[model samples]
Target: MKTYVCPACGLVYDEAAGLPEHGIPAGTPWADVPESWRCPECNIGKTDFVPMEL
Candidate 1:
């Protein structure tokens, strides 16, 4: 699975280790994440996230 990084705060969202704290279960894919879900670290929208290089 791929990972994403928040541009504002460098928060890393790993697809294999979903954000359970935000109700996103483990192994959840990026496309499955709600559009309204913001970065927990910086509160930035999903558009602010970029694909991180593995």
Candidate 2:
């Protein structure tokens, strides 16, 4: 699983535990982000997050 980081706020979106209630659910494909989710902390769109390697 990849880790996503919020470019605006530096929040780390973890695939392991999921994105909390504001995140995409487990097994959610990237294509589904637009309709399925939003950032928990800032309510920003999922597209704002970049995949974080570390």
Candidate 3:
């Protein structure tokens, strides 16, 4: 599994459990993350996520 890091707050997105059940609005794009996934802490778009070594 790949772990995603939030560039805004340095929060790591867990691939084991996946995105939260309900934090980011429903239908939020997670597939093409770096282009659409939003930061749960800051609500910033995917552009804020920086892939880190997991």
Off by over 4 Å in 1: none
Clashes, model 2? 0
Give the local distance difference test score of model 3.
0.61
lDDT (tens digit, per residue) of candidate 3 on 16-37: 5566564543334445344555
lDDT, model 3, position 32 = 34
Tens digit of per-residue lDDT, candidate 2, span 1-54: 667888877877666656447546775545555654666667777777888877
Q: What's the lDDT for all of these models?
A: 0.94, 0.68, 0.61
TM-score order of candidates, best first? Answer: 1, 2, 3
Using lDDT as the measure, what is the rank order of every candidate, best first?
Answer: 1, 2, 3
lDDT of 1 by residue, 1-54 (tens): 999999899999999999999899999999999999999887999988999998
Q: Where in model 2 is the C-alpha error above 4 Å?
A: 21-36
Residue pairs with colliding backbones in model 2 are none
For this target, which candidate reaches the highest TM-score against the unseen true structure?
Answer: 1
Best candidate, lDDT: 1
